[model samples]
Target chain A: MIQFSNYDIISNLLFATQWTILLSLAAFIGGTSVALLLTAMRLTRNPAMQTVVRIYVELFQGTPLLMQMFLCFFGLSMLGYEISAWSAAILSLTCFTSAFLVEIWRGCIDTLPKGQWEACRCLGLSFLQTLRHIILPQAIRVATAPTVGFSVQVIKGTALASVIGFVELTKVGTMLNNATFEPFKVFTLVALIYFALCYPLSLYSKHLEKKFNVSR
Target chain B: MSLVNLHQVHKYYGDLHVLKGIDLDIKAGEVVSIIGKSGSGKSTLLRCINGLEEYQQGGITVDGNEVTTEDIQVRRLALSVGMIFQNFNLFPHMTVGENIMLAPTIVLKKSKAEAEEIARAMLLKVGLEEKFDSYPEKLSGGQQQRVAIARALAMSPKVLLCDEITSALDPELVGEVLKVLEQLAKEGMTLVLVTHEMNFARDVGSKVVFMHQGKVWEEGDSKTLLSDPQTDELKQFIGAVL
Candidate 1:
């Protein structure tokens, strides 16, 4: 049996956190791009485009994130294509993050008064112009708090990438536990690292809510 | 020549008819005040004129151009017809000056300096020149409505449509907004307004239109219509609201 020192376990886990942060940023930036497209399609006057977006949102949201990761990693490989674990993890997490982000932003848009649309239209602003100039400005104010709050969820979600053999923080912690037979110390450190990453985001979201509310 | 003409215009929401074969005409510098009970289709008429709500049949001509669902035509009509709402509808996120300057800069493609100049002039016209940097939420209801009027006038529209601009204001605040409208009338701005202020309509309106049950029930010079009612519905409406 290879014995592991406390310093070795902590250091390995800290190194793995870099991967976790990288994956989280990848998923967030990618998810936001896709979410904006989904939101625009959902808001379009075309019923068919709206239905397609709705189904996409429902499929991602209704299924478990773990199942989605398995499908991307295992199912894609079974179909005779070589896929990297990194790609699988990112693809699944991005789809998962976008589904929730679209709904959150769409709710913000819906909160605006209907008269806003009418008023903008009367001013000769087209649909896209109206959205850019009027609707989105207001929606962004309402969406900021919830959007920042959801980023904490995305950071936490990066832990699930470990199950797909991504070698993130959780995967590194499990390996350390096996080598040292110290489940408590290893998992406790893992939890602490996640808390460090997420707590500031949670606090920031609350601050945004308070700031916007006061302005309103 | 009439600046706005609605000939046999009809509008429906599903099976419910909201405007029925209405014919109206207003020459330049005319102040036409439309008044009626709630659900009398007064607001719908104002919306149809601006193409915010499309009428099912007939034609609306503003400044000699027919109102259509075609994007360019509607946009052209919008250039000449400005509208204000009961709720004010000033963009809450933008400052008063930005709100006033938005359409002119974007739709009219005015330079920032030009739009700012127009915004300042319009705000001055509405007596809110001091509110350039203030957000809508920071203002009282009356002040916000005045800002909305300035925002509309920043486009230099030939005819302004106001749908109950003072209905949402508090009792004391209503007077301020109505006073601004009165000032606009004095300046010879062709105005179409849906209002609950019967006294203002009588005093300032060149023509008063009484809408009931999706039709123009009675219309005449404000003084003639207020003192002498041709229909029983007009008599009852005048009695209740007054």
Candidate 2:
């Protein structure tokens, strides 16, 4: 049985936690923008636009993220793209995150009643004007909770990037565990770090939802 | 020239026919009440006038622009033809002032300050000045309906259509909405109303049109139609209700 000092293992895990947060943030921002576009397209009446959005959502939702990561990391490099693990991880996570975010936002939009549409129409506000002023303001109340809660999923999802040789917290912990042959101790620290990042965000989301519901 | 005209308007809901060849004309400063049993096409006729509902076959000109062909033009025409719905359809998120000011600011291009002033005056006109900052849910049923009337009047519509505006309210609350309508009619705002209140039909309406089975059975001066002997259908209807 191999063994290592406690300080060595704990320090290595602590150092990699920062990279996990950074990777999560990059994936989150990239995903949210794409999701906004997908959701808008989903709401459109144009058949072609809706079809494209539906295909995009289905494509991402249908495939496993592990397969997507493998394709992003290995397949692109084979095609002479010369992508880094960081870029591959970001791309895969962004696509995966977008599909779910689009669905969450669409649910928020659906919660609005049909009468709101008629009320805006009779007031002579153009479609965009009505969306910007009337619909979106109300939708924001609903979208806030799920959006923040989804951030936890994003953070957890970044751990999968470790399989592609991305040096996030999980990857670093795996490397440390291999050097010291202490899987239980190293993985425990990694799990705690992930908890630290996600738990606060989860609480904040719940708080926001309760506050908004009461105000409404 | 009449402020509003509809010639042989017919609206169909798939296989269910709603408005069957409705012909109507309203002159300036006229207050016409349409009374009928439920499902008698009273609300559909009002909705068609405001361009809220489309008719399959007919000509509808409100102040002269054809509404059936273009929704945008109908919207433009709707600027001068305001409507009040049975449910009061107010924007629940916005304040009473914001609800009244939205159309003027967006559609009429009025400045925010100008819109606010118009909104304030309108709310005062409807006896809702104190509730300007309140949301629709915060207000009572009568107050919300009054705010809806104020919102419609803020557009400076030449013709106003009230589609069972008081039906959703409590018996006591109904008076507050009708009182506001009475004041608007008194001030010479051309109005068309779909109402169940027989007293309102007899007192405030200069002309009464009784609709039965999607057609106007009889139409004449309010006093003549309500008091004097008429068709058997009218006799039975009045007998059943009274």
Best by lDDT: 1
* Per-residue C-alpha lDDT of model 1 across residues A1-216, encoded as one tens digit per residue: 777888888899999999999999999999999999999888777899999989999999999999999999999999988889999999999999999999999999999999898788778888889889899988999999999999999999989999999999999999888888889999999999999999999999999999999887
The alpha-carbon deviation from the true structure for residue B91 of candidate 1, after best TM-score superposition, in angstroms, is 1.6
Residue A97 miss distance in model 1 (angstroms) = 0.5
Residue A61's lDDT within candidate 2 is: 91
Q: Which segments of candidate 1 are over 4 A away from where they belong?
A: B69-71
Task: Write the residue-wise lDDT of candidate 1 on B22-120 in tens digits.
Answer: 999999999999998889899988888887778999989999888876667778887999999999898888899999999999999999999999999
TM-score of chain B of each: 0.97, 0.96
In model 1, what are the clashing residue pairs, if there are any?
none
The reply for model 2, stretches above 4 Å from the true place, is A1-4, A74-82, B69-71, B216-218, B228-236
lDDT scores for all predictions?
Answer: 0.92, 0.87
TM-score of predicted chain B, candidate 2: 0.96
True interface contacts retained by model 1 = 0.67
